[model samples]
Target: MGKGRAPCCDKSKVKRGPWSQDEDFKLISFIHKYGHENWRSLPKQAGLLRCGKSCRLRWINYLRPDVKRGNFTAEEEETIIKLHQSFGNKWSKIASKLPGRTDNEIKNVWHTHLKKRLSSKTNLNVDEAASKGSLNEEENSQESSPNASMSFAGSNISSKDDDAQISQKTFEHILTFSDFTEMLQEVDKPELLEMTFDIDPDIWSFIDGSDSSFQQPENRALQESEEDEVDKWFKHLECELGLEENDNQQQQQQHKQGTEDENSSSLLESYELLIH
Candidate 1:
C-alpha cells in the first residue's frame, strides 16, 4: 500500500465520476447557506456522497458565483503569455493577477492551446530560414535592391512618426499639479491617493505647471519656490500613505496565516477520524 492513509470517502458508498445535477444543486445550496471552512464535514451536512476534496474542487473550479466562463479575450491571452514567461509554471500566482481565472483553467488553456501555437510558430520560422540559406546572398540582394532600400526607409519614417504621435497623446493625458491636488482633496481613502501616485518620483518633473509662458526674473524666482513647496508636500503625503499601506498589508498577512493554521488543524482531525 501507499504511505498515506486510505481515502476519506468510502469508495463503495460514494458516487464517483461526473457529478449529477441534484448533487450540484445540493452542494451549491449548502455552501451558500454555510461557508466551506470545514470541507470534510460538509458532504454529510449537505447530504452529498462526494468526498470533501471533490466538493472543494467543484466549488472552486466550476460552481463559484464569480467564476467567468466562455472564451478568453485577446488581451487576456497576451497577459497570460507575458506572465507565464516571467513566472514560469507558477499558475496560482499568475491567476491571482487575472481576476475570475482559476489556476486549473489557465493550466488547461496553456497545455491545450498556447503551447501548441508557440511550437508551430517556432517550426515555421525555422523552415523559412532554412529554405533561404545563404546570408551573403541575402545581404548582396538587399544592397543592390532599390525596392528593399525604399521599403526600409519608408518603414523607419513611419515608425518614427507613430512613436511621436503616441508620445504626444500620452503627454496630453498626464496629470497637472492642480489636477493632482484636486484629486487628493476629493478622494476619501488614503490608499486611492497612494495608488494614483505609485510611480517614479522623477516623473514629477514632467507634471504640467500653471504657467507655461516666459516670466521676469522676480516672478520666475517666486514660481520656483512655490514648485519646491508643492514637491515637498507631495513627498510627505506619499511617505505617510506608504506607511499606512504597509501596516494594512501586515495585518492581512497575519490574519491569513492564522486562518490557514486553523484550517490545517481541522482537516487533520477530520482525516484522523475517517482513517480510524
Candidate 2:
C-alpha cells in the first residue's frame, strides 16, 4: 500500500490537461468577485472541474490581470542576468525586482536561452595566460625589491568571462603567500636580478580615490537635466489639461447666456403682439 494518504481530488471527476476558454473565464471571474483565500477550495467555489493546484497555476501564470506576457525587453534581460549572478537560482527573489514577471517564467527563460548563450561565448585560455603573467611579475618584483609595491597595466581582455576568471585567479594567488615565497626562493640568483616595482605615491592616491573619481561632475549634471525634463513634461501635461477644462466651462456659460437671451426676446415679442 502507498505510505501517504489519498489524493485531494478524485482524478476521474476533476479535469486534467489544457484549460479551455470557459474554465479561464470562470477562474478569473471567481477570483475577481471573491479573492483567493484557500487555493485548495478555490476550484470548488469557482465551479472548475480542475484541481486547486491547477487552478492556482492558471490564475498566477496566465489569467491574472497583472501578468505580463510576450517577449522580455533588453533592460529586463540585463536585470535577470545581474540578479542571477548575485542570487544564483533564487528565481522568486529575482522576479520580485522585475515587476509583472513570475519566477517560473524567469527560470524557463534562463535555462532555455540565457544559459546556453553565456556558455557558448565564454573563453578561458587567454585569461589563464594573463593571470599567470601578472602573478610571475608580482613574484619577480618582491624577490628583486622587498620595499616595492606591485603594479599591473590594464589588460585589453574584452570578454566578461575572461575578466571574471582573471579576477578569481588573482584573488586566489594573493591568498597564497607561501607559494609566492617558494617561487621566489627557486630563483637561481636573487642578488643579480634588478626588477623595479617603485609605484608612485600619486598612483596610490589615484587607486584609493577611484570610487569617488568615477562619479564625474558632468554625469551628475546630466542626471539632473534628465530629471528636470521629466518634471517639465508632467507640468506641460497638467497645464494643457487645466486649459481644456477652463475652455469647457466657459463654453457652457456662453451657451446658457444665449438661451436666456432668446427666451427673453420671445417673451417681449409676445407682449407687444398682445398689446397691439
Candidate 3:
C-alpha cells in the first residue's frame, strides 16, 4: 500500500501559540549554528517544546537577525503591490523580492490595506469615464429641491478577479478611452501635441467584408445587405453617366474604384486628426 500523508504537527504535544523569548532564542541559536535544510526535524534537534512548523515560522518571521522589524517602508509597500500584480497570490515569491519580509506579513498587508488602495484607483478611473461620457451622471442637489451636489462611488471589481474578468468588464471603457483624452488635455507644452497613426492601407476592404476570411459575426447579415445596396447604387450611377459596355466600362470601373479609395483615405485621416 502507498504511504499515507505525513502529519505536519501534533497539537497535543507541542506549543501552539505565540513564541516566547526563550523559544525564539533556541530556534535562532540552533539555525545560526546549523542551517534549516530540513524544517521537519529542526524543532526536535533544537530542544524546543514546539513543532518544527512553529520553529520555522518564528525563525523566518521574527527571530532571524536580518528580519526587518517595525512598520514597512513606503517603498517596500509599493514593491509588494507591483510584485503582487506580476505574481498573483504567490506570497512566498513576493517576499523573496522583498528583503527581511515574510510571506505571511506580505499577505496580511495586502488584504488589510493594499487591496482597497488598488480597488479605489480602478473605481476612480470608472467615475472619470462616466463624467466624460454624460453630464446626467452628475447630481447637483442644489439644482433639484435645494440639495447639495453629490457623486456616488463607482462600482468596484474585486481584486479576487482574474485578468480575463477585469478585461471583459472594462471593455466598454477601452472603447471610449477617456484616459488618453485626459492625458492630451493635460499636455501644456507645444511638442506634446504632435502625434501620428500608423495603419494598414487596405483595412477598408476588410470592413466592407470583401475579404473572404474576415467578417464580424454581429454585423455579418447587415454587411451583406449593405453590400447589395452599394452594388445597386453604383450600377445605377454607371447607367445614369451613359458608360458604354465597351472601352468606357473599364473607365467607369476605374472612376468607381478611385472614389471608394479616396473616401477610405479621407475617413482614416479624419480619425487620425480626432485622436491628435
TM-scores of the candidates are: 0.44, 0.44, 0.43
CA lDDT of every candidate: 0.52, 0.50, 0.48
Residues 1-276, model 3: lDDT tens digits: 447966777878888897653455456445534557778888887777888887878766755433444455445566778788899999987766665467989899999987987777667786765643443333222225322111101123345655345333423222112332233233312343222110111111111123121212455454345544334323322222222222344444443444434443443343233222
Alpha-carbon RMSD of each model: 22.8, 28.0, 27.6
Best by TM-score: 1
Quote the lDDT for 150 in model 3. Answer: 16
lDDT of 1 by residue, 95-181 (tens): 655554678998998998778866775677766566335433554555565533221121112323553343333234345565655
Clashing pairs in 2: none
**TM-score for candidate 1:** 0.44
Per TM-score, what order, best first? 1, 2, 3
**Which lDDT tens digits does candidate 2 get at residues 146-191?**
3222222112222343423544332321312233223333321334
Give the lDDT ranking, best first: 1, 2, 3
The positional error of residue 212 in candidate 2, measured at the CA in angstroms, is 44
Candidate 2 ranges with C-alpha deviation above 4 Å: 1-6, 123-276
lDDT of 2 at 112: 87
